[model samples]
Target: MKKLLYIDANVNRATSRTERLAQALLDRLRANEDVEVTTLVLEDEGLAPLNSARLARRTAGTAAGDFSDPVFAYAKQFAAVDEVVIAAPYWDFSFPALLKNYLELLCAQGVTFNYSDEGVPTGLVRATRAWYVTTAGGYCGDYDYGWAQVDALCRLYFGIPDVRRLSAEGLDIVTNDVDEIMADALRAIENEPL
Candidate 1:
């Protein structure tokens, strides 16, 4: 079975519209293939950003090719997955800081990526594709910074070329019907090919 990593970052998962949409996508994907999903609920994982002391340890571990530390768990897991799903709500034109923290942890050298002979980055991640899901209160037309950043990192740093963005936007628009819009988004997820 394919190992699929699902990173959940919805702040209010029990009633989060973003979470519901992502679950639908997950269900559809599972129906089409045999997948073993490993979910990392960001809220449950007490992840911290890299600090001076943490950076020093990370550097030492990477230089010595010894990632036995618990800090390397996220990076190692990220590199070992065959597919990825990142679900976060759009806040202030980008994703929450918790997702950023997780991404920071995943950017470990010699773990998720490494330098080539020419000093260029070559990804070590085994994932072939990643789906970024987000819900926005307003239209995410030209300023979809969250998706843009994720796509760039996947391609430029992680060597994941098949990055796809799935979003449900304008849910809070007074003129739009939230339920109707959500149903349409569900249909889109069902019809979208894996």
Candidate 2:
């Protein structure tokens, strides 16, 4: 079965606009395919940021070819997925710290990516496509560092050739209709090519 990995970084799980949009998109995608979806909720995962000790453990594990360590679990899953979808609300010019921490673990060398003989990076991830869904209170314009980072990771590290983004901006603008903005974003998601 085709495996789709959904990385949820929506802090406001129950009422997050980004989560709502991502769910709508995922529902449509599911309707069109026989894919198995697996979700990773970053907020509830209790992932610790990489530190000296954790880095040492990861290094040793890689050297020993023992990826049975819990820290490498996410990376293994990430590398094996056929597709990826990340839902995260824009915050303070980026996504939440929880997602960043999760990515650190998922980007483990010898797992998600490795180096070529000439030192070029080679992605080990099996995913062919990825989607990033997000909502911004104000206009993100050119300051969308979160999506940029995700796109870079998908292309440069995950070997996902197609990375698309769906976003709703100006949600907090006093003059804009929130429902309309969200509807437009959902429509974009619906119209996206799977």
Candidate 3:
């Protein structure tokens, strides 16, 4: 079975349009019956950005090639996954800070990546593809830095070759039909490849 990790950072669960899209994606993946999905709701994790002491400990652990610490659990799980899906609402040119915090912990060296003898960083993750889902109240245009950051990280740092994004824009525009916009996004999700 393929291990798929769904990292949910959408805060407004009560009225989250992003959650609808994410659920669509999950439903599509589950249809194959060969995928095992693991959901990680970021708000529930209570993850924090690494502190000075934690950073020092991580540095030491990486240098010593020791990855037995509980702090590496997230990285290990991420590295072992066959697929990843991130759902976060667009905010201030990027996703939520909660997703960023989770990412910080998942970027552990010798876990998600390693330095080559030539001093270049090589990815260590097992995932072959990832999907990033987001919804914007207005047109993101060239300012969707959230997807850009994730795309680059998955490809350059995590070696995921087929990183893709699904976004619903202008959902809050009074002129746009929110129902139609969401229905279109759902159609796109239905056509997404496994």
Which candidate has the top score in lDDT?
1
Tell me the TM-score of each prediction against the true structure: 0.97, 0.97, 0.97
**Stretches > 4 Å off in candidate 3:** none
What lDDT is reached at residue 110 by model 3?
A: 93
Q: Write the per-residue lDDT of candidate 1 for residues 1-194, one digit (tens) a residue.
A: 99999999999899899999999989998999999999999999998899998889899999999999887989999999999999999998999999999999999998999999998999899999999999999998989888889998898899998999988889999999999989989999999987
Worst 10 residues of 3 by lDDT: 113-122
lDDT tens digits, residues 27-127, model 2? 98898898899999998889889999889989999889888888899999999989999999999899998888988898888899887889877889999
lDDT of each: 0.92, 0.90, 0.92
Better of 1 and 2 by lDDT: 1
